[model samples]
Target chain A: AQRVTQPEKLLSVFKGAPVELKCNYSYSGSPELFWYVQYSRQRLQLLLRHISRESIKGFTADLNKGETSFHLKKPFAQEEDSAMYYCALMHDYKLSFGAGTTVTVRA
Target chain B: GAGVSQSPSNKVTEKGKDVELRCDPISGHTALYWYRQSLGQGLEFLIYFQGNSAPDKSGLPSDRFSAERTGGSVSTLTIQRTQQEDSAVYLCASSYNTGQPQHFGDGTRLSIL
Candidate 1:
């Protein structure tokens, strides 16, 4: 069994400030981690994955196996970056998701 | 032909009625998935289809919930005797492989009154 936890339900930050969304997982095997984002009235899309190792739209995440953490980070937050973010773990045949965090960037 | 598409974008069904949600995955994709999103809840995995095989159905809440994927491209989820508690946004996703990044649809909002 695998589980994902995103402790904060809502996070608010000022525009141009740095932002980080915390995510932790519990898995024994080699697991795949991902960060998914959903904008207002839009479908959920893949923001970035740990395996990709690429900065997507200025956002990047590093997988920490020892701590079992995969936190999304952005150097400079923009007003348009405000949205719902979910962290997931692909375990076997199922993908378990975290409760999610609602990010609000105040301009 | 494009991204994953779900039919009946918004459905309002009465309690005790049956509802079916459809999903058309991207062309040539062999894997499909069904998920549910409720208020304040991120996304819950309901089922996954990998070339017509779903090894995980444990996420399904009850026997009233069922899903099937045929021809390895399209899928449908059926809920029998729907209850108000079942009202939520049903989402479908697909990928070329099990480990591939998934593409999602806008989802179908089901309201059981």
Candidate 2:
């Protein structure tokens, strides 16, 4: 069975402060990892994928195979960054999602 | 192109009643999936239809839940004799194929009263 775990249910940081949303997964095969964000009243959209190794909105996540982790990071947080972030694991046709971290960027 | 679209943005029904939620996939998407987002919970896989192949229904919570994809374009998830426990936002997503990024609809918020 494939599982994604986001240990934090909520993370708060002051504006301009660094933030990290930790995610870990357990999958036997080479894994595909993604971080998805849902802003208030908006559709869930892909933020970044580990395979792409690209940054979106100043956020990037590096998959660490040794640790079995893919943690999203940003040097600075913006007030608009307050949203629900979900970490997902792709398996076959299904993607198992974490419980999600509600990030609050306080000004 | 437009993303996945789900019908009846919000539905409130009494317990024991049956409810049907609809999904319209992207124009060229060959894979459609149904997921449930319960209050304060993560997305739960419900079912997936890929191309013309049989759907994977292993994620279904119980026999009370059933879904069908017609003509490889639209789908409807039916919950028989619904209970308050069935309350959740029913999300529909579609992808070009398996392992591809999925586009989701705003979802149908079903409140079983």
Candidate 3:
């Protein structure tokens, strides 16, 4: 079974501070990881994907095969970055999502 | 449509009633997924449909939950004899294929009283 674990339920950071949301996965085969963000009054949107290797809204996540981790990171937190972040693992055409981490960037 | 569309943005129903949620994927998307989001559970996958093939209903919590996709485009999720535990925001997403990034709909908020 493929599983995704997001250790933090809430991450609070001051503006301009670095932010990292930890995510770990357990899967026997190759894993496809994705980061989805949901802001207040908005629908969930794709923030980034491991396969794309592109950063969205200054957020980037690197998939580490050895450690089985795909942690999302941002150099500096902004008030606009405050939202719910979910890590998802895709395998066999199904996606298993983590419990999600709520990020609050204080100004 | 420009994006995945889900109907009945909000629904309130009494326990034991049946509810149906609808989803319309992107114009040419072949893969559609149904997920449930609750306060404590966050997001849970319910089912997946690829074209007109049989859906993957492994994530469904019980036999009361069922889904069907027709004409390889529109899908409907049916919940029979709803319970309070079933209250949650049901989300639908679509992707071009198996490995592509999915686009999400606004979600249907279902409340069971």
Candidate 4:
């Protein structure tokens, strides 16, 4: 069985402040992690993937095998960054997603 | 279409009625997936299709749920005898191939009364 846990349900950060969303997964096989973001009035879009190792919209997540964690982080948060963030683990050609964390950046 | 497209942006149906949701994946995309999004449940994988191979129906909750991709382009998800618990946003996504980043549709919001 594979499961993804996102500890935070809601996060509030001031503009220009750093933000981190915690995500932990339980999977026996090599995990493929992804961060998907849903902005207001928009469809869910790929934020970043662990395999790609590229940051999108200043957001980056690194997969930690030892800890079984893939936490998304941003150095400076912006109002546009406010959205629902989901951590997803792909295994067996299917995705298991964590209960999303809603981020609100206050100006 | 340039992106994944789902029909019937919103649907209101009574319990016990059957409903079918349609999805048109991006042209040339070979991989299609179906998911359910609800209040408590973030996203639940329903089924997946890759090329002509048999679909991975393991994620489907019950026999009442079924999906098929026609000619590797359009996909339809059918739910029979819907229940109140079936009310949720059904999402469709597609990728160039298996294990690739997927592009999502706007999702069809189903409300069972």
Best-to-worst DockQ order: 4, 3, 2, 1
Per-residue C-alpha lDDT of model 1 across residues B1-113, encoded as one tens digit per residue: 58999999999999999999999999988888899999766589898888845446777889999988877878999999999999999999999888888899999999999
Q: Best DockQ goes to which candidate?
A: 4
Which residue pairs clash in candidate 2?
A: none
lDDT of 2 by residue, A1-107 (tens): 79999999999999999999999999999999999999999988889988989999999999999999999999999999999999999988688999999999999
Residue B18's lDDT in candidate 1: 97
Q: lDDT, candidate 1, residue A14? A: 98
Q: Which stretches of candidate 4 lie over 4 Å from their true place?
A: none
Best by TM-score: 4
Tens-digit per-residue lDDT, B1-113, candidate 3: 69899999999999999999999999999999999999888788899998777888989999999998988989999999999999999999999988789999999999999
List the pairs of residues colliding in candidate 4: none
Per-candidate TM-score, first chain only? 0.97, 0.98, 0.98, 0.98
lDDT by residue (tens digit), candidate 4, B16-87? 999999999999999999999998777999999999999999888889999999999999999999999999
What candidate 3 gets wrong by more than 4 Å, as runs, is none
DockQ score for model 4: 0.88
Clashes of each: 0, 0, 0, 0
Q: Which of the numbered candidates is closest to the native, going by highest lDDT? A: 4
At residue A24, give the lDDT of candidate 1: 96
DockQ of each model against the real complex?
0.75, 0.82, 0.83, 0.88
Classify candidate 1 by CAPRI docking class. medium
Task: Evaluate residue B44 in candidate 2 and report its C-alpha lDDT on the 0 to 100 scale.
Answer: 94
